[model samples]
Target: MADPQEPRMTAKRFHARPGVEDWRVLFWGAHAFYAADSLTHAVALASAVAEIADGLDHHPDLDVRPHGVTIRTRTRRGGGLGPLDAELARRVQEFARGEGYRPDPSTLMVTGIAVAQDRDADVRPFWAAIMGYEPLDDADAVDPQRRNPHVWVHELTPPKPGRGRTHIDLSVPADHAKARVEAALAAGGRLVSASPEGWTIASPDNHGVDIAIWPDFEDFGEDG
Candidate 1:
């Protein structure tokens, strides 16, 4: 039997597990993206996942689509990924594999807009009002219906003088980050920077965007 008091799994540890290494497990949290064949197939998979989650007393964020389903699991109470998430991911993948649905990290992408401001209070409301987004917190606003990407305000000291104060943040599965970066580079996007967390690619017009591999956990800042 597993010890109930065991420490939660860290991002590094989670990626080292067999079978899971192939999945798009984020370094900041635990998540898995699976692709289905059709809407009917997605619904069926979600139903199965719900049953398993109910049995385990653990639930995951499920986004069902006409041809794909994304699963994100985290320890809400603990504020990060835990052993429960790992177990749930394993079970979910097992079921997905059995159903002939392979893990497709390329299909899952999260977009966010970042604004650099000297004071968050100075500019948050304007963007929030214009975008019709609700305050996720003091620093960020999100679409009430979850249909649009998030908008984040970052406090920068002595704000840089330039018109390009905003940039797009793209979160992709860790396994596919390099491929995505390469594709962007091939398409005239220049590499601004690179790190284990992700890469910053600039468009032909000099607009910057980050290709992140980590899961977008609220309140953890861009690093998450």
Candidate 2:
């Protein structure tokens, strides 16, 4: 048996699992996100997952909705992903596949608003109060109900010109980054820039939106 105190599995190792390539598993730091179709399918899958988790004494955070279900797995004991999470993900993938619940990467997308300001402290509270979101330790705010996108205030030295101080940040699985960018491009959006983290897309009117992989170290917030 592996040591219970073993360090969390690295993102590279987690992505290297045997059948993971065939599943729609997305690596986000210590956690992995999986999406299922339909509430009924999600409920059924959750039931099976619950049983298996009970047997293994490992549980994932589950959000079941009318359109889809989101599964997030991490090892709290290890403070990140580990062999246990990998094993459970494999089992979930197999079961979900057998049940005809296809993996949908688009369902894993999360949105957040980014505001560039000279002083984040000046505007953070106002946005938080208006949105009814609680402040995270890093000074970012998230919807109290976890239903709305997060609002992140990033400090800029002199700030930029134009109506571009604020932008939308769309967090997607790394594997789906290219496809999402392409889709946006095809829809009249233009690519402003690209990086390993993700792409910056701009609307015809000049508004910017970032399509990025979930940051390995930043906790964007939980899903509803």
State each model's CA lDDT, in order.
0.72, 0.67
User: TM-score for each prediction?
Assistant: 0.77, 0.72
| Per-residue accuracy of model 2 over 1-224 as CA lDDT, tens digit each | 23555655655666777755433333322233345556776688788878878878887767776555667666642125668878887887787778776666555766789977664236788789999988875647877555577888887657544323789987676766788888889999998998777789999899999887744323332220
Lowest lDDT 10-residue stretch of candidate 1: 215-224
Tens-place lDDT per residue, model 1, 100-198, is 886776776777899887642367788999999887645788776655688888876565544327899987777667888998899999998997778
Task: Mark the regions of model 1 whose C-alpha exceeds 4 Å error after superposition.
Answer: 1-8, 17-19, 26-29, 77-79, 119-121, 129-138, 143-147, 157-164, 214-224
Highest TM-score against the true fold, candidate: 1
Error of 1 at 214 (Å): 5.1
Number of backbone-clashing residue pairs for each candidate, in the order shown: 0, 0
TM-score of 1: 0.77
